[model samples]
Target: MKNWLLHILVNAIAIIIVSFVFSSVEIEGFIGALIAALILSILNAIVRPILVILTLPITVLTLGLFLLVVNAITLAMTDALLGSTFEIAGFGMTIIAALVISLLNLVLNSFIKD
Candidate 1:
């Protein structure tokens, strides 16, 4: 449970950083980032797997690169859920934001022990 909370904090930080890096990605504030992070984590857990399974063929065909699109989809979903608080300019920007967030999470998560 503590680890999960830590992950959420990490994700929130990532989201905040991404917002700063990309003008197209907008996060209202720390609280908004936290909420977006929680929504993203939930969507990744609940919706991502289903999407992965459903898109296995394409995922395999693209040598797993299609997973990035799946990631973007979740980001878009999060943006939709949060409305104005978390806004992504467009699908293209969302894909780039997703990649940035994934890389940020990878780096951030590495500092913590699971």
Candidate 2:
């Protein structure tokens, strides 16, 4: 429970930071941001592995560059599901947002020691 709550908090911060960094992405408010983060986490956990496997060939062919596209797609899907709460405008913006969010998640998780 504590870990889950920490995850939510970290995601909320990531969303806020990403939205601030990119004009194309927007997080409406705290609750909306939380919901978007939760949805994104679920999508990343469940769907991302299958996507990675199916796209392995392309991923290897591109020397791992295809991972950016995968991340953008995941962000776009989260935006679509969360409606206006999370709005990722285009592929470029999605990629930028994803990079920022992933970095933020890494930094937050690093401090948790678990």
Candidate 3:
């Protein structure tokens, strides 16, 4: 439970930071960020693996660069799910924001133990 909560917190912080950093990414408020983070967490856990597998050929062909697109897809999914509260404009913006979120997650996960 503690680890789970920390994970959510990390996501919330990452989303907020990304939104602040990118004009195209807009998170309404802390609550909105939290909700977006939760949905993104769910999507990443359940959908990311399938997407990575489904697009493995492209991922391999691109020498793993296509994984960034998959991450952007998940980010776009979060925006679509959250609607106005969490809006990410354009594919490029989504990809950049996703990259920031991924880096933040990586750093936070390193500090958090399961």
Q: Return the top candidate by TM-score.
A: 1
Ordered from best to worst TM-score, the candidate numbers read 1, 3, 2
TM-scores for candidates 1 onward, in order: 0.98, 0.91, 0.93
In model 3, where is the ten-residue run with the lowest total lDDT?
A: 105-114
Model 2: per-residue Cα lDDT over 29-103, one tens digit each: 888888988888889889889899999999999999898888878889998898877788888888888888988
Model 1 C-alpha RMSD to native: 0.5
Backbone clashes, each candidate: 0, 0, 0
Tens digit of lDDT per residue, candidate 1, span 1-114?
Answer: 899999999999999999999999999999999999999999999999999999999999999999999999999999999999999999999999999999999999999986
Badly placed stretches (over 4 Å) of model 2 are none
Which stretches in model 1 have alpha-carbon errors above 4 Å?
Answer: none
* Model 1, residue pairs in steric clash: none
lDDT of 3 by residue, 1-114 (tens): 788878999999999988888888899999999999999989999999999999999999999999999999998998999889999889998888888999999997898767
What lDDT score is found at residue 14 in candidate 3? 91
For each candidate, what is the lDDT? 0.97, 0.86, 0.91
